[model samples]
Target: DAGVTQSPTHLIKTRGQHVTLRCSPISGHKSVSWYQQVLGQGPQFIFQYYEKEERGRGNFPDRFSARQFPNYSSELNVNALLLGDSALYLCASSLGGGNTEAFFGQGTRLTVV
Candidate 1:
């Protein structure tokens, strides 16, 4: 079965533009999380959308948001993008919320020019 999948593998956007990145979790997984990985830094947690409850979000600005669908897929949306937002956006899936083992996708690399 597929572990986790993300779309568009690569993207380019301009400052002030808005972009949406999509993710599909593994079969039967109910929780999805978004992370941003900048060069030379670790992955920073962005948002977690669970099947049954609200999990948590990172310290990102209001421009960042996400939603989980009934099918357990997810989308991360960023509005008014900035050059600082250029990074690898990762999606992870788990059996449930909290510290469960998460399976991650290769991620969508976003470049804000």
Candidate 2:
């Protein structure tokens, strides 16, 4: 059983360009969440989708968006990219709501160059 898988482990984009990051959750997992991690700082929650519905969001700008598919796969979209957006985009999956243990993927390293 795959814990969590993220594609295009690395990405290079110029400012103002849009990018989409993908993730696949473990079998039987019903919740998928996205987090942004910048070096020297902790991971910040971006979005959480449960059963295909968004359940929570973080203090990120409107440029960040995400959605979960019926199969439990997820995608994180960032629009109008900026150099500050360069970071590791991580996806985590959990069984369900309330105190569930989450599992994370390797993360996509987005570089704004």
Candidate 3:
């Protein structure tokens, strides 16, 4: 089975612009979650979706949002990007929500200038 994957291993954007990151989860998986990891810090959960419905969200601003698709893939969108938004955008997937173990992808490194 294919594992979770993220596109554009790295990205460079200017402040005030918007960016979108993509993800594809493993086969048979129905849950996808997004996280942000700043330098030297653990990943912070951003959003989680199961069966195309939002299941959980973390302490992030409205500028950060995401959605899961029927095929179990997902996309994270960040608007009005700021320099602080520069970080590793991670995509994780699990069998289902709750206490399930999640698999992470390589991540998209976003750099805002």
Candidate 4:
């Protein structure tokens, strides 16, 4: 079984720019969640999508948004990026949104200059 996968591995952007990070979930998974991990901090959930519907969201600003595709892949779009937005954008997948253990990708490290 293929595990969750993310793209770019690393990214660099400037303030006020936009960036999109990608993720592909494991097979048979229906829930995908986006998280941001700052240096030395735990991963903070940004959004959770299940069955192609928004299930839960985190405390991030509107600038942070995401969507899951029919194939269970996902994309995280960050608009007007800021220096504080520089972090490891992690994507996790689970069978459902309840309380299942999440499998994470290596992450796309985004650095906003």
Candidate 5:
């Protein structure tokens, strides 16, 4: 049994570029969510998807998007990146939605210059 797993543990991108981060939730789980963590701050929820549909979104701009697949894997996509976008992108999965206990991945560290 494994927890949530994210891909490409680290990445570097330029401003105005696009980046796609991947995640695969634990077996038998249906809820997948994405979060952004900057140094000195807590993780901010970005998007949550359950059963392949988006259930919620955070205060982020339109440049952020995500989707869950039938198998419960997900991808977080960011367009028109900015320096502010540099942070650790975390993926979490739980048995259900909101406030439920979730398992998180190590996260993909993105740097935009």
Candidate 6:
């Protein structure tokens, strides 16, 4: 089976712009696997959706949003991008909820200028 995959591996945007990142989980997974990694920090949870419903969210502002698709893939959208939003956005795939082991993708590196 394929591991989780994310698109555009890298991006660059200006403040106030919007961006969308994509993710596809392992073949049979049905959960969310989204996180943000800063220069020297651990991954920060962003969103988690299971069975097409939102199950968890982190302390991110409303500028961040996401949805899991019927096929188990997901998309993360960030509006009004800020310089602080520049980071490596990661995605993972799990069998069910947060407790399950997850497989991660290469991540999307967004650089806000």
lDDT of each: 0.94, 0.93, 0.93, 0.92, 0.94, 0.93
Identify the runs in model 5 with alpha carbons over 4 angstroms from their true place. none
Q: Candidate 2's residue-wise lDDT over 1-113, tens digit each?
A: 66799988999999999999999998998999999999999999999999999999999999999999999999999999999999999999899944269999999999997
Better of 2 and 5 by lDDT: 5
Candidate 6 lDDT score at position 14:
97
lDDT string, candidate 5, 61-108, tens digits:
999988887888999999999999999999999888864688899999
TM-scores of the candidates are 0.96, 0.97, 0.97, 0.97, 0.97, 0.97
> 5 or 6: which has the higher lDDT?
5
Residue pairs in clash, model 4: none
Model 6 CA deviation exceeding 4 Å by range: none
lDDT of 1 by residue, 1-113 (tens): 88899998999999999999999999999999999999999999999999935599899999998999889999999999999999999999998886459999999999999
Per-prediction CA RMSD (Å) = 1.0, 0.8, 0.8, 0.8, 0.7, 0.8
Q: Compared with the true structure, what per-residue lDDT tens digits does model 3 show for residues 40-89?
A: 99999999999999998999999998988778899999999999999999
Alpha carbon lDDT at 53, candidate 5: 89
| Angstrom error at residue 42, model 5 | 0.4
Instruction: State the lDDT at 11 in candidate 1.
Output: 100
For 4-107, candidate 6 gives per-residue lDDT tens digits of: 88998999999999999999998888997689999999999999989999999999999999998999999999999999999999998899886459888999
Q: What is the lDDT of residue 78 in candidate 1?
A: 99
